[model samples]
Target: MDKFKKIDVEQLNIVDENGTVRLKLFNNQNIPPAIIDGEDILPGHRQSDPIAGMMFYNTEGDETGGLIYGSKKDEDGNYTTSGSLTFDQYKQDQVVQMEHNEENGKKNYGFSIYDRPNTNLREDIIKDKEIRDSKKSENEKIQELNKLWEGNVRRAFMGKNGDGDVIVQLSDSKGEPRIRMVVDQYDTPRMEFLDGEGNVLYKLPPEE
Candidate 1:
């Protein structure tokens, strides 16, 4: 079930003209015009499909928006809300799925938004090595690891001045890996890595 499940056209300003409906806007307010499928809503995307679904344009047409889907009960006690979006797994966009339950006049909305990139550790290894070798300019590499393995393990890295540093990695209950480097002051210039639990995982070899 996706999040865009429940909607009401009247609640969202979806108007009926002849047979086709269009979203109306206020003069001063700036928001994406919503798409209506009967009473269902489809929010516009921030990037692609700019003018296809719903048009929230100014005099010049600078569109910034996202999709919104919904569901609601009718006077006859029937519920309806619907819309859909296609996604490429590699595109790095998020998917939101939703489900709703209504009984005795009380409604419950449940949803999940998948926001993580699929794992290909082997491909990531080369990228990780590049980060390790590059002069430690930004914390992005470390942060990437943290985000990549979040909730699965504790990880850290340690290294030193010249060479011969061993990388240590550990996994938590979920078997996600985080790295640690162990190197001495005499090794090729590098910093020490420590895990969230403050455990030292790797130590670099002594400089020759």
Candidate 2:
């Protein structure tokens, strides 16, 4: 075996004994699409999608989750960068995630957790991705995707915001944040209850 102090490569793939792709590392110029359970995710790309990242596969070659990062600068000096670490629930959706993002000087960092129904999230995502790719009006696409999320996965979000505020939020089956508790930058704490349409119904410790 040859030993080297360091290795530089354009791309790398780690496969399992059964020749299944367990992990992959690649340069930003050549990024691969998402694959789960040996099934490829629909649509090769999204609007300014991440350019580089590493993906992980489960025992059955299903994509459990990944960590990805991307950045871009345009001629007009506008720029955006983002990174995310995620973990998918078995047979469901991404139940945990940590993410950081910056765009045109605006920066944010947060993490979240979700609860999904029994449906296979991998399939649901693929189907939704394909449906999203259909050549329909932008408004139509949004409406269609919303249909898929109603009463599906999505449950809660608990994290800190860019403003240094920590929050715990609960959602309804339709993926609406119905409740939220927050500790602000100055450590001021408050809680809110909202209706399904996002109208605030009440607040704990009424405002001064």
Candidate 3:
């Protein structure tokens, strides 16, 4: 057994037997870009405003998911902080995540599950960048991007909102809330069932 009393490192990587990076821990300055299929996608984008965290990689060197956290305070006493743990779908974005976010005096924390399409995210990223850089109008670009990434949906969320309300929400496949249970800041508990159009079709108390 070997041990070092004091070790300081800005970045560290844990590699598998095949020399593939399985896990990486890094500081903001040393954060690595998102790597997929042995290629760095959107290089330099993450480094521009990096957060200190560790990233997980799959056997093929694709980013799986990671934990990230950071806090910053401006000179005027305003502050922002956030932390997140995520598990990504293969070749896609996060399918499950727990997150905490605070900006100024607002705070929100939640665990959520998402449904993503089978489309490869690497191709979507490249296409998104192209759409942004295209000569098309802003509205046209937005429409195209929306159509490109349509199947990404938040399926469920259970957490405290910025307004201090505890909420458990379940949505349909189209991302419409079908059920919502909440305990508001005032400690009033209520449950509601909604239609696809977001109309409250039923309530616990019958709305009497």
Candidate 4:
């Protein structure tokens, strides 16, 4: 085995015996595009900003999930930082994730579990892009996109919000929060149950 005191590299790939890329480590400029079912789909899905991170691939080379983090200070001296570690659900999107996001001096961090449809996420993304590029009006596009992405639901989240409250929220299938337990910034603890329409039905302590 060869050893080096230090190695400088922008990107690296770890492959299996059959030469399939099982994992990839990369810099912002070297990050690979999203790969699904052996096809490279939306290249611009990550948006215009550059992020450095690593990607995880399954046995068939499909991207399952990965960890990514980036921080930047703008010309106006404002700071933005974000990081996430996620695990995908088969051919779908993230089923579980831990994330942190901060901008200026505000911060939010949480762990979440999502419920996604069995449909192919790659296909949905491509169709969404097509709809956005078509001649449809904004309302029509929004309606179609809403129907298309309705199956993606966040089922649970436990995190500290930007307001400094620590919260554990659970939602229904339609992504409506049904229960919330929180510790406010002032150290007040409260638990509430809500109806489907988000009206608080009950609280731990009876109000005056």
Candidate 5:
């Protein structure tokens, strides 16, 4: 045993015996990219990167998830910040996450789970994102994806919403909020049952 000493470091990476970066801690100026399957999918873009966080890698060097935080105030006097710890599905987007965010004077905190798709569905998602970002109307493309999204990656979340209300939301495969429960800042508890189209069909207290 030896006497402990203080250590100062802006970034640190813990690697496996094979030299795979299984864990990394970095500052905003040196944010690291996501590594997947021993390859970097999205890397830091120099000063443009706003994240100050640690990334976690899988045994194969793929990006399983990360914890990140960034905050800044623009010249216009608006403050923005967000922090999240996320877990990714194999070969897909985030499947679980704990997040807290604030923007435009609103704040949200919660945990969520996202269903993942198979290989074929993953390709569809990639294509759709590209189309959504193109200089074209996304209506048709959104509808197209909607048609294919049935029974795909659904989502559910429980959190305290921006208005300081506790909320639980469950979405259908089409990404429609089908069920919801809320406890507002005033401690009023309410529940809503919705149809497939997200139209509320009933309320726990029954509407007047």
Candidate 6:
């Protein structure tokens, strides 16, 4: 397809909403045809090899999407790899390390996902206290503001830092009427509410 090389975890896109996760797999390399061995590679590959370098997008919470590298099986094909990489042993060889970026305000949280077999790494995100605290605080503030509106509201992004502000976005119940709420270092938000046409509706008073 593109140029064959080690997987770039950044390019993979996974969007998940509710309990359903939408996974779109596109490789720069032509998926290696099929590994040979006695290999019904596709079938066995899906069961054993961990889908390497995957990005996760969690629409529901903090554990949205990121790069997946390590040992994993498509036991139920939740990831849709059954037809591509089929067996367990093939999956073993497929394991890889992945890098992920979690957006926070104007900054991003960067980390890696490692293969468990022979790859020892910390599994929890909280290991980075500063990043974890920022995400949690950001989520809470956004949730509070979400309850103020009657329509659909969402936290568009959360990054490490920038202009010393935290940004939260709101959309209509059906996800329109886009608005941005930027929280300052003191946790006060300077509001910029806009309509579907991107027109500013009005600005609210800063939080005291």
Estimated TM-score for each candidate: 0.19, 0.77, 0.91, 0.91, 0.80, 0.27
Candidate 5 residue lDDT tens string, 66-164: 899988888999988899999887765688999989998899989999886654434555576776777766787777666656455547999988889
In the range 1-208, model 1's lDDT, one tens digit per residue, is 6686775442343444443334433221233432222221333433232122333222222222233343456698776543322221232223343333344444444333343346533344446677767777669768876665443332222211123333343434343333334343354434334455655454344333
Per-residue error for 206 in candidate 4, Å, reads 2.2
lDDT of 6 at 162: 41
**lDDT for each residue of candidate 6 in 78-180, tens digit (9 for 90 to 100):** 3322112211112222222222222222333222122223211121112333343554677764564443222322324333244566655555544554777
On the 0 to 100 scale, the lDDT of residue 184 in model 3 is 98
lDDT of 2: 0.78
State, as a TM-score between 0 and 1, how close model 3 is to the true structure: 0.91
Clashing pairs in 3: none
Q: What CA RMSD would candidate 6 show?
A: 19.6
**Runs of candidate 2 exceeding 4 Å displacement:** 46-50, 121-148, 160-166, 185-188
Model 4: lDDT to the true structure: 0.92
Q: Write candidate 4's Cα lDDT for 20-134 as tens digits.
A: 9999999888878889988877777674555888999999899999999998897999999999999999888899999999999899999999999988978988899999999
lDDT of 1 at 145: 62
What tens digits encode model 2's per-residue C-alpha lDDT throughout 1-208?
9999999887788998888778877777667665555666644653247567887777787777788898889999999999988898775557888888888877777777776666776678877888888999999989888877655645777776777788888888768899999999999999999999998889888866
